[model samples]
Target: MAQALGAQTIYEIKQALHRCPVQLSRLVIHKTQDYALELVDYKVLVRLNPLCKALYLLFLQHPEGIVLKEMSLYKTELWNIYLQVCRHNDLKSAEKSVAELCNPLSNSIHEKIARIKSSFETLTDKHIAEYYIIAGARGKAKKIALPPNLIVWQ
Candidate 1:
């Protein structure tokens, strides 16, 4: 779908056409392949760096969303995911990276999330990207807007 027209206009057109079910690419997370991200409908792979992939996987797992200030609570989970996704052999270095990412005082996590957003933006229109990206207002829980039914864990 070309986004040359405004999102509202697109919505109105879809409404007029009576498109009951909006078509959205399903996001597949291959857990056996270290949580690889893919758009099954589009036949596209969403590549993210190790840390970013870890963060994204975490967000996907918790559709309820994760508040930034409370990221420390999920540090262990993130670290475990990072370990699976990262190719480095240095476990200590990986642990340190997770520590930095989960630190409330550090902006590392935000940077990784920004990269994740950029990756999705390049792959799809903003309206559709919103479904796959992690987003939320300040002081609130950030989450992927994609519905659970559209997500597959293999």
Candidate 2:
């Protein structure tokens, strides 16, 4: 029946079915002036590699995000050392905790921290901070307010 209606494959049919429930709900909500799609919460899981996990975890501990691209330029040596520490850790959990403990001073994780802060700042406008906070909080939903304003570059 799905194919007859122009869904090409079984995967397409499944995809359509998966999305139908949401679409139907949205359609019903559209009837109400107060309801909007932005209010709906949808989640997708991403599996991160060990290194990114370590980096992401470290960034979570900092109130400001890290700036990877700029940090790579200004603090190559410190970044290399941190990368080495990430490689030495056995488990992702240990890597995450150790990375936080290893760099308590903002100057210690300076470049990496800047990069992460920058990334989060960039995402603030798009409602991506919720995802970051969700990931950082390890799936614990915590209420977070967006920063006053993201720093804009010229």
Candidate 3:
């Protein structure tokens, strides 16, 4: 009789778990509208510093990944993205910011990437955040691990 009750309790617990709603977060990048980042399922906007946002968007665009040393190749693209995301109209300052990021001698790129990682980790679980972060080993290409289907670019 005790065994029967335990089995019934287990079945009830499973049923309860099945009934609970699971939230699947989808990241939506608003490309045409100021490069805004949004969690579609949660209806929340993720705020990243202008430069960090530009870096994140660049990674999102390149699923194949990007090497740190090769950032100079993307200086133009990054600068363009930064221009749209940044509220200020200081073109010279924005250009300088992108130049520093592409300069291997400076640690600006690393700092921006760290800030971008922190932004996502704060919004969700570490495992989930991994999908939204720029990560890779030294001397290898870094990329966001999120599935392409989960990312929506507008």
Candidate with maximal TM-score: 1
Candidate 3 residue pairs that clash: none
Tell me, by lDDT, which candidate is best. 1
Quote the lDDT for 104 in model 1: 99
Residue pairs in candidate 1 whose N, alpha carbon or C atoms collide under 3 angstroms: none
Estimate TM-scores for all models: 0.85, 0.24, 0.81
Q: Residues 10-39, candidate 2: write the lDDT tens digits.
A: 888876765542211111112132211121
Better-scoring candidate (lDDT), 1 or 2: 1
Q: After superposition, how far is residue 48 of candidate 3 from its true place, in Å?
A: 0.7
* lDDT for each residue of candidate 1 in 1-154, tens digit (9 for 90 to 100): 3243333576676655444345789999998887899999988999999999999999998999999999999998998888888887888888988999999999998999999999998988766788899899999999999999999989
By lDDT, the better pick of 2 and 3 is 3
Ranking by TM-score: 1, 3, 2
C-alpha lDDT (0 to 100) for residue 33 of candidate 1: 86
